[model samples]
Target: MMKMMRVAVFVFLFLGVAAGAARAGWDPKDDEKAQQAVDYIKKNAPALDRFFVHAYGFAVFPDIYKGGLFLLGGAHGQGYVYELNTLVGESTVTQVNVGPQLGGQSFSEIIFFKSKADLDNFKKGNFELTAQATAILIKSGMATNTDYSNGVAVFALPKAGLMADLTVGGQKFSYRSR
Candidate 1:
């Protein structure tokens, strides 16, 4: 009986390792970056309808979780980044996992730019919105008019059932690379 229990534990641990390694595979059906980015934007369209008629100055980033435990053998964890488009009021989603890490958080942000140059940079870079760039979480708690940086205005409202209203903003967005 003890031997059986030990074997079961081994199997569970083995499968967990395998599952963690395969965490970075995105949908292969449409393999196009632009299309996926569009789809991602459309999924959250209702939240961003205010910018619908505009020429396209909005980008959506999704939620991300970053963490991992490194075994004495090696380190492993996963996270993704996305780019979005709402030119025709139809958006797209694209995803890429950052690979193994020792420790860090997976974070996603939906960015709405007010300038054409910023939007163009988004397209050319395949949507690498990093801290080197400028960003803020609108729906995020403690987000206020004062916290905004750059020329960007963060307008966020509730999307899910979250009751986070420490302050009032604009859109309720959920974006991922998809």
Candidate 2:
């Protein structure tokens, strides 16, 4: 019963934070953070530098806050969208998850689009990363033998915290031009 109550309280806190984040508009700080995140990723996962050079575009989320307790979980983040290395817009990601999961974590995520069509699709505000879209965790000295799925490749670098999950979720995104 105590554990269940703690989970309930966590869910409420998560919802409050998510709601507050949804109302946040574009801020220059996001740009700064995004760039820092990109630099960090490049330093840690040098292999991903090739994608920055060749990919048509990408979205970089500097901090994605995710929390899960028992069977309910959610994540939210704000990011910048780029095309050919140029910042074109701002985007937000909200995810809902359900399954066996616990703990909270924060991470940086980048989604690379392989072609114009894929980038356009994301810009049109119709992009959602389904369960089929898996993100490779970028860790130093780790081999990455991954490829784009449906013209997009996702990578994540954990910033802090620990979480264990077997949950299924989809990330929904919204975009606005700068």
Candidate 3:
């Protein structure tokens, strides 16, 4: 009985510590940052305004930090999800790639769902961007020729740093309702 009690206590403490560590990386002002990111996209890539208007929903990540060394690289970011412009939840994205790559960078990203079913799939936790998925880098006149490849259109604006990579990876997302 004592051994079982000790093991249970250890598991509880470990889970608590893990949760705290996860929350530690989040900023109280990230909501504000997400808003800023939306505004930045509006200003920098006015052509994307159409997606904002027509998308069934979207996820905005204010800043994604990414790095690569030799054959392995990964990226992570936290963001907010909106439905018809209404804030509904929070989301996180993590990506891993393997290729001959080097360098690092930070950027803001937004993914726009073309239909309710697409957004619903995202919320249901069944959405993933495969290695073939591509994001349109936001810039003046850049998005004018782009459209949703699948049901969602992804756009990214560089924030800082520089990375040159030829990698094949997938992005996995998790969502939590607010």
The lDDT values for all models are 0.37, 0.84, 0.80
- Quote the positional error of residue 91 for candidate 2 in Å: 0.8
TM-scores for the candidates:
0.33, 0.86, 0.82
Give the worst 10-residue stretch by lDDT in candidate 1: 162-171
* Cα TM-score of candidate 2: 0.86
Give candidates' CA RMSD values in order. Answer: 11.7, 2.9, 8.3
How far off is model 2, as Cα RMSD? Answer: 2.9
lDDT score for residue 68 of model 3: 73
lDDT-sorted candidate list, best first = 2, 3, 1
Worst lDDT 10-window in candidate 3: 15-24
What tens-digit string does per-residue lDDT give for candidate 3 at 33-89?
667878887887788888898899999988888877666677878789989998777
Q: Which stretches of candidate 3 lie above 4 Å from their native place?
A: 1-31, 141-143
Could you give candidate 2's per-residue lDDT for residues 1-178 as a string of tens digits? 5788577767756675756454455677767876887787788778788788989999988888998888778888888889989888878888888788899999988999999999999988889987878688888767787888889999988889989999998898888887
* Worst lDDT 10-window in candidate 2: 16-25
